[model samples]
Target: MAKKQDNTITWDTFSEGLWRENPVFVMLLGMCPVLAVTNSAINALAMGIATLFVLLASGTLISLLRNSIPKQVRIATYIVIIATFVTIVDYTIQAISLDLYNALGAFIQLIVANCMILGRAEAYSSRNPPLKSIVNATGMGLGFTLALLCLGVVREILGAGSLFGIDLFGPRFEPWVVMVLPAGGFLVLGAWLLLFEWLKQRKSETELNPASES
Candidate 1:
């Protein structure tokens, strides 16, 4: 997990979420929806975009009203605002696709409690201007979406031999059934985290090795 930022540049706030402090891979927030809903690429994309909408919308509101809300009740206020947006998102998703809505289940409503959203609202948005808050939220949301897509794409291809329901492996390829199961989420996510760590270490070593870049 990352520390709550009281002060930082806009770029730092935004970029940190994409890599150093990703909500899922690094910070590990909102695992329920991540594990439960990412059985396919489309599902993962839907969930990610839904979360992004809620975060960005609520962050803007929290930043604009930061001065009016008393510190003592700010958490509750933030929840209310987030819940409002979540409801809107939930209904919107339902209208667009009932199957997606059912697949997401309570996880959509649960977005209101996602620590990543509330964390930004309290730690960064509340103390910053609306523009900065939106930028930071955008970063966090996109990072979250990217992480989701990573698992989703891997699972869909291996588990079902398809991406978004289009057959990539043709009819002959055998699918890994376990890849679409609940355990698959954990396995894939863990694999991705390890892969990222290895790559990060390699990049650091490459940068530090004096003879290579000269």
Candidate 2:
């Protein structure tokens, strides 16, 4: 028999999805787009929002249909749900702003292939209650947004001398052209990952050695 889960545990599960087990920074599930579209702050923000929308929508639908879906075909069903939302977001962006839409291009449609969405559906949404599943999905989406925003800020400031379309360092500071290139994306992401890993390791060591008397 399965042990009854406490409400507090559910909250922990949800929170962990956001930070501790983030799909991008921690699990590193979806990196192709994260590195490709993050060349500019605007592009990064747009991709993050689009991903969040798809994750939430797909998670909710999957949770709702968990009981009805057969174990064998669940993966296929979840993929279809995800693909539908990706198409909706893609067309919506095209209709709203052709420039932004063109900037995103095939990357927007590629959200269908993002492992985070399907991973959440198969791992959490399929087994958890609807409310809990939504919370988990939201947390994971927010974590992804946070990571993207960090990358965007770094790239934009160095590459364009501006952030979100506003110049921050003024005219005297020449933009580093490399920051706007693909190589810069890889460099920035690699450095950030290294920093995160170092911090996490230090935290773990500190926690383990908290009591000097031992």
Candidate 3:
């Protein structure tokens, strides 16, 4: 049998989810929305925050019910919980502003389908206490938000000469219309992945060959 993890280890697990094993930049899970909704920084931020709220709430709830839930139906139960939260977020956004809600479109509802939420419920929440699950969910959600923000910044700057709806570049700036297109999303994401891989390799090499050790 696998050894049980100490509760203290939850912090490490939680922090790693935010950056080291980020679902978007590192693990590369839930790329569809990341690419689709990042045309503007506002949309990206809205989506990220919505996802974060759902993830935290669902994780905590799932962890609380872990023992009581039958193992066979746990996945289904978790999905239902997650879907309910997503629906709440969806309506909340719609009520706040129809434009923003329309900007996000079906992607808001699709949060229920995001693998990160379900994966967390099964892999982390089901195995840990409610507090730890909340921490983990927050970390993972933040990581996802960070990645989306990065993509949104890149796309918005190149496509619209703006950042979060604020014009940074003047009229002289000629926006690369393609940056707002589907092809541009893929290109930007691909380049970001390559950059991440390169940095990770460099970090690994530096750690392996530190001057003090040498």
Candidate 4:
């Protein structure tokens, strides 16, 4: 079991989500949307923002009502709260851009099932005050967004020879069709995971080797 945090709020409470506990790279939560809708940069951004809003809004509401929620039905209650925000996101996206809505498909609605948001609610938000929960959720949301963009931008550029639908390479350049495919998501995600792991390993080695410091 994880240690429970105190009421005190610190920078680490928020910043941990950005890198140390990134939902995608570090913690590996919510990979469904991460891989499914990240073929294009625009799609990835939209999904990330939607999930962020849900995380923040739900975290706030859950923190405020944490005491009242019965322990027996807490999980069910959390889902209800999460689903409400997801519904709002669903309708808003439909009104904003039909093309984007189609591109994202059912993944947007599936945000309700994202363990990252639920985990925050059950583990963090339910224990902390609203203010602290908001800060933590913001950091986590941004981290998830950053991870999605990393994959999306790379996939889009290599797959379509463009970013956010804007052409970068001319007609002469051939796009790597695999980058935009489902296999592309797996390939890119594996590559990113390897890179982060390598960096972490190198950092650990540096810390252990006192001689290298000299």
Instruction: Estimate TM-scores for all models.
Output: 0.90, 0.91, 0.93, 0.95
Model 2, stretches more than 4 Å misplaced? Answer: 1-10, 208-214
Ranking by TM-score: 4, 3, 2, 1
Ten contiguous residues minimizing lDDT sum, candidate 4: 205-214
Q: Which runs in model 1 stand beyond 4 Å of their true positions? A: 1-10, 209-214
* Model 4 C-alpha lDDT per residue in residues 1-214, reported as the tens digit of each score: 1465677788988888898788899889999999999999999999999999999999999999999999999999999999999999999999999999999999999999999999889988898899999999999999999999999999999999999999999898899999999999999999999998898778877786735632
Evaluated against the true structure, the overall lDDT of model 1 is: 0.89
Q: Write the residue-wise lDDT of candidate 3 on 1-214 in tens digits.
A: 1135877655666677777688998787888899999998999999999999999999999999999999889889999999999999999999999999999999999999999888878888899888877887889999999899999999999999999889988999999999999998999999999998898778768795645421
Clash-forming residue pairs, model 3: none
Best by lDDT: 4
Query: What's the true lDDT of residue 187 in model 4?
Result: 99
lDDT of 2: 0.86
Clashing pairs in 2: none
The model with the greater TM-score, 1 or 4, is 4
Better of 2 and 4 by lDDT: 4
Worst 10-residue lDDT window for candidate 3 reads 1-10
